[model samples]
Target chain A: MSASAGSEQILHENTLYAEPVFHVGQFPITNSIISSWIVVLLVLVLAWSLRGKIKSVPRGLQNGLEMVFETFFGIFDSITGSRKRTLQFSPFVMAFFFFVLLNNWLGLFPGFGSIGQIVVEDGHKLFIPYLRGATADLNTTLALATIAVVVSHIAGVIAIGWWKYLNRFLNFKVLWEIPQKVIKEPTILLINPIKFFVGIIEIISELAKVASLSFRLFGNIFAGEVLLASMSAILAFGLPLPFMFLEVIVGLIQAIIFAILVLIYLHIATAAEEH
Target chain B: MESLVSIFHIDGKLFLAQLINFAIIFFVLYKFAFKPIAKIMQERTTTIEKSLDDAKAVAKKLAETGLEQTRVLNEAKKDALAIVEKANQAAEVNKQKLIEKTKLEVAAIMAGEKVKIAQEKEESLKEMKQEIAGLVILAVGKVIKEKMTDDKDKKLIAEIISR
Candidate 1:
């Protein structure tokens, strides 16, 4: 098939690219990044505007903000099982919630995907200009996952001293103790190997956390965006509206899941295994 | 044609992209949104707790004042009752003394009147005895005169005197 004569050949070249946003060297900025920035600015303005009016007797926006915190605190307390820890860790948890929530909701904005410049590549015109959902991008999700994992580890280190936390990954001392334990009880050797293997598996599980956290958020959000786009392309009118509302709910759920997962990671990290 | 699952496959580039994005978002949010909100919430909680403390202090003060007022009222009531009791006792003693004094004065006046009556009775008895003696002498003289004639009686009386 001649490139220009082919039926699949289109006016826009870059429109058909699977990933709409690309990187400038190391930085993987996308429509999601722009949206995230918008969200950040929005949050900053909202918080900054209402900074001084914190009242004991709830009034206006302060009341609303308090209710939100109380709710977050309550949920966090339930997860962490202590108000002290919730307060101790509330900053990270609440930040996760707001960021994830905003990023997910930003995808639902009108003209995010549809309103962008057309890029030409390989004699075909493509639509890749601006505005992709941050969560839809693997970069956003993976970055969040890394932060969640790394920060949680740091929290673990702080909560239970560094050596104990390091013991989670490497436990040669426990392995060395096996000979002495086996002398006392013949069954100790079998149990020791099992314990050793379990610790190894625990190490793998920590690596798995990155995969799980990133993919879960990316898949759900990306799938929702694709679903909306495809539905709108198919029906073009009334059919997409209801699904838009459904996507709103989905967006909220995905945001909640991401935040809760981060919170759970933090909770597990901070908890001492208690012998 | 590749399957739909192939499109969603995990890749290193995807992970890298997400890792960087997450870092940016986390930092941005930490600086702008989360930190400020957390601070506001903490400040708000402190404000509420302070108001509660102030309310408690005021309540304690009110309780103390109430107790003080009650104590003062009780003391005043006790003092009033004591004064009334003392006045009653003084009145009773004064009434008893007045009664005893009046009785003594009446007894003295009665005794003096009785003595005066006795003295008057004695004087009257003496006077009556003197009157009775004078009347007897006069009667005796009259009887002698009647017994004798006048001149002969007088001459016999003179001869007796000379003897």
Candidate 2:
């Protein structure tokens, strides 16, 4: 399988980052970006094909899609505890799930990491594949997590007024109420400051959510890719099959976990705070 | 931060591209898949509910009609029975009247026959007395040589017949 493009030998290694494939006006297009674009195109085409066929009675593909949607809706409802909230948050969460899932599964295909060009840099040959799993890249997962967390805050602001949503982090209302309560209940002097501190901690936790969300997805998918590469490098054929199947399951699980976390965040964000 | 960036190769342009990609997918899938499918499901649920209500209404109407039919049938049967009973009573009255009228006519005919028989017996007895008287007169005449007249013989015959 080793072919000579020049006097340099091709070196294939599982990199922690998505390699740049091409450049367009100072913007480098990475393999992960390509995979993401392919996922987007595939999803758009599937949706477009199923669009006109959606009927009230629902037959064939429509029937299967409706069942899947209903099941997912039920799962969202269980997290949000309200169907209205689930419906409001479903688009973003479902997009994240499908995009991540397709990227993970598509990365396991035959020619994804195997088919590439040999680039000679400083007399050292590097094999750069044309496609990589989008979730394996930290940039993609970070972007999705940023969107999820930011949208949750926006949804919170919309659901409960902006001032009320802001109180989740800053808690200025509790601090302001201390003077009023101090005369009636002197214990407010101690409890209100603690509550304000807790609100500060809440802000830290929100940041933690973004970090955890992005890192978890990136770590899982990246590790799966590394594992498959190592297994194939060891035996070149049969050894990677089991790991591929494991990656498939891991891909499905990570997608579900990411979607569920987003839904939970949405649910928590939109809920009215009890004073 | 530099080490992390260089190690992971986090690019701002790539992040933006991925975000745009996810946004496009979200809007398209929402418009083409979820929205229409949810709407159709809601419609199917409402249609099923409406059909169930219509079926319930039809069943109730059927039950009501069945009850009305049973009531009407029972009323007609009662009326028929009453009519039959009245006809039987009328027939019995007519039969009794006919029997009474026949008995009275039979008694009257027996009385008329008795009167006719008494009259005929009286006429026959008078004729027999007259013949006996004539015979006695003839015998007396033969013995006493016609001592009595015809008018006196006739009067004696009438007296003997009356006795």
Alpha-carbon lDDT, every model: 0.72, 0.88
Predicted candidate 2 versus true structure: per-residue lDDT over A1-275, tens digit per residue: 33554545568888899999989988999998999899999988898789689888788878987887788999998888877877788877887888888888988888887777778777678999998888899999999999999999998999999998888889999999998889999999999999999999999999999999999999999999899888988998699998999999999999999999998998889888685
Q: Label model 1 with its docking quality class.
A: incorrect
- After superposition on all C-alphas, the RMSD of every candidate to the true structure, in Å, is 6.8, 3.2
- Candidate 1 has an lDDT of 0.72
Q: Give the range where candidate 1 chain B is weakest over 10 consecutive residues by summed lDDT.
A: B1-10
Q: Write model 1 residue lDDT over A116-200, tens digit each, in one string.
A: 7655678665667487776776656667788888999999999999988877667665777787787788887777677767778
Q: Please give, for residues B1-94, the per-residue lDDT of candidate 1 as tens digits.
A: 1442355333455556555544555565566545566676778778889999999999999999999999999999999999999999999999
What ranges in model 2 sit over 4 Å off? A1-9, B124-163
Candidate 2 residue pairs in backbone clash: none
lDDT (Cα) of model 2: 0.88
Docking class of 2: medium
Tell how far residue B64 is off in model 1, in angstroms.
5.1
